[model samples]
Target: MSRVCELTGKGPITGNNVSHANNRTRRRFLPNLNDVTLMSETLGRTVKLRISAAALRTVDHRGGLDGFMAKARESELSARALKIKKEIEKSLTAA
Candidate 1:
């Protein structure tokens, strides 16, 4: 799988590493991603997602996966996460 955060869309960034001798080297800065399984209260299931550590903290701060998904913008989420968000919304409406 690609090194991308499903929720926050955080990914590797390209940059140059500068040295003391005024030398520059190409480098990539990757996001701190973790494979986590978060439980969805509305759907009554656990969803596995590769997301950034910051996003995980945001989910915790927002009260849960459902709350985070509800508040997150559609453009920021990955395709899979967008689908899960839709399912969560549907379950919420059904409940």
Candidate 2:
């Protein structure tokens, strides 16, 4: 997908790159994103998402991502995995 964090909604930023001659070129600052499968407790399934490294770190630091997902899966019969699956399908259709 795009160079964006789906969880945090972070995307590439525009900036300028300067040369020795003071000439400027367009530059893009992209977030560090990774495709990961997070367990969903509410749905008893896994949720795959493109998240930024920072977001992942935050989840890891909180020690609640997994637990929250599990709870979500258990609570939601139509789980987040299904949503992800649909979203992927929609993307595929557009492509």
- TM-scores of the candidates are 0.95, 0.61
Q: RMSD in angstroms, all models? A: 0.8, 9.9
Mark the 10 consecutive residues where model 2 has the least summed lDDT.
68-77
Error at 90, model 1, angstroms: 0.6
lDDT of 2 by residue, 1-95 (tens): 45766555668999999999999999999888898987644345666777778877766765645433333333222334345545544554676
lDDT of 1 by residue, 6-74 (tens): 999889999999999989999999999999999998899899999999999999999999999989999
Residue 34 in candidate 1, Cα distance off native in Å: 0.7
TM-score, structure 2 vs. true = 0.61
Please give the lDDT score for candidate 1. 0.95
The reply for model 2, stretches above 4 Å from the true place, is 66-95
lDDT score at residue 16, model 1, on the 0-100 scale: 97
